[model samples]
Target: MRKSSFMRISKSISLIIFLFVCNNLQAQNQSYSTNSKSDFWRNVQFGGGLGLGFGSGYTDISITPSAIYNFDQYFSLGLGAQYTYIKQKNNYASNLYGGSIIGLFNPINEIQLSVELEELRVNINLDGSNSNSQDFWNTGLFLGAGYRSGNVTIGARYNVLQDDSKNVYSDAFMPFVRVYF
Candidate 1:
């Protein structure tokens, strides 16, 4: 082969090899991004709250379970369930069971905001000694604000759907602590 011809052939082969390598690298990077997206469960978190109180002739107990799916670092949506029981010496006994849906937002790393809607069934037995009972359904919408750190938050919420004369909670405002894993 002539010197110029040999040199041209070598240069062409080198360019082809370089282009092939670059194409394969780009394909690999695309594949990696796809695999990363499939890791949906990694963004899910589970948590809730529990409470118990007892005193002379009075008892209260509560349990809540919740799960949230983080869409990104800034937002999440969750579902929750709650059950509560209360007994007063001779006056009454009550059971509250409920479900809720909540939306959470983090405008900054340390501040969080939330909105929650809840539906509850309240059942009460009058005069602990008799079978006289009352049952009703209650609904509440709450707006909340909190301070957040890692997987924990401390917050307060105000119920937009509260009645002054008759409500499960003593006040329209309530405080909370939340933790998730």
Candidate 2:
């Protein structure tokens, strides 16, 4: 009877030790996963760009002032406005105003995919030749992809709204560069 009692005590002690080891391993794995998720979203950022807008019968030099909001490492949204001088063959000059909303996706570290919806308008001088000046309005869309790293960004957009009344749409692939601050 004494030998049987001793064997039962040894089995109970071994079972307790095994349970303790398994619990510790599970806790360690859970902590590591939580830490990685925290590091992905702690960084916020901003930038500026300069490029050319060409379409129809008009080709203009433009400047883009931009800003961005980073919600996390995986996503961001941006806004930009562009201004340019429209130089025509008739020696008449006008001003162009444009705005855009940019969405960014981070698929890998130091790289991004950008999609944008851009709108533009041109102010024309109708009175320069007729003594009664008039203004012309033009609008269009641009869709493209971009790559970014550190403080520098570069991208190319395909012109989707290249057809307009004044032929003022940009029909070529537009490339741009940005500097983040």
Candidate 3:
């Protein structure tokens, strides 16, 4: 082929190859978007907390496990289950089992505000007396605020539905330290 015609053919081939690559990339982009709609598991995060307290003839143990689905970077909703056992030697023992639904909001990168509604079933029995037992259901609404750093958040929560005498929690204010992956 002549020099000018050969150069022209090479340039045309380069343009065609560029066009094909661009079209292929665009198709891949569309495919990713479609698959992202069904990728619910990717947005889910799992986390939980464990607690223990011990004293002379007294013991308290709690287990909580939770899962949250991140709607975006700023908002998430999750469900948590809690099991707590308290023993006071020669006095009484209590078993508390509950579940809570929580909604979390991060208005800023360093702050988190959460609202949780919990329903618990409490059972109390005396050490030596089997006939005298108490079983009831209690509900608590907790509003919490925290300071966030990386995956850890330290904060306090106030229970709006706390009772002075018949309460599962000893106090209305509880502090928590949480870490999430």
Model number with the top lDDT: 1
Q: What TM-score fits each model?
A: 0.77, 0.59, 0.77
Which regions of candidate 2 deviate over 4 angstroms? 1-44, 50-61, 88-90, 126-128, 131-134, 164-166
The residue pairs that clash in candidate 2, if any, are 54-170, 55-169, 55-170, 126-134, 127-132, 127-133
**lDDT ranking, best first:** 1, 3, 2
Error of 2 at 151 (Å): 2.1
Model 2 agreement with the true structure over 1-181: per-residue lDDT tens digits: 6988888987888788888888888888888877766654344355666667677666678778877777777788888888878666555677778888887777775676777777777676642575644465555556666687776767777667666446565354778665767
- 2 or 3, greater by lDDT: 3
Ordered by TM-score, highest first, the candidates read 3, 1, 2
1-181 per-residue lDDT for model 3 (tens digits): 9999999999999999999999999999999987886688788888889989999999999999999988998999999999999999999999999999999999998999999999999999988889988899999999999999987889999999999777688899999887777
The local lDDT score (0 to 100) that residue 45 gets in candidate 2 is 54
- Candidate 2 lDDT: 0.70
Q: Say what the RMSD of model 1 is.
A: 8.2
Query: Where's the lowest-lDDT run of ten residues in candidate 1?
Result: 126-135
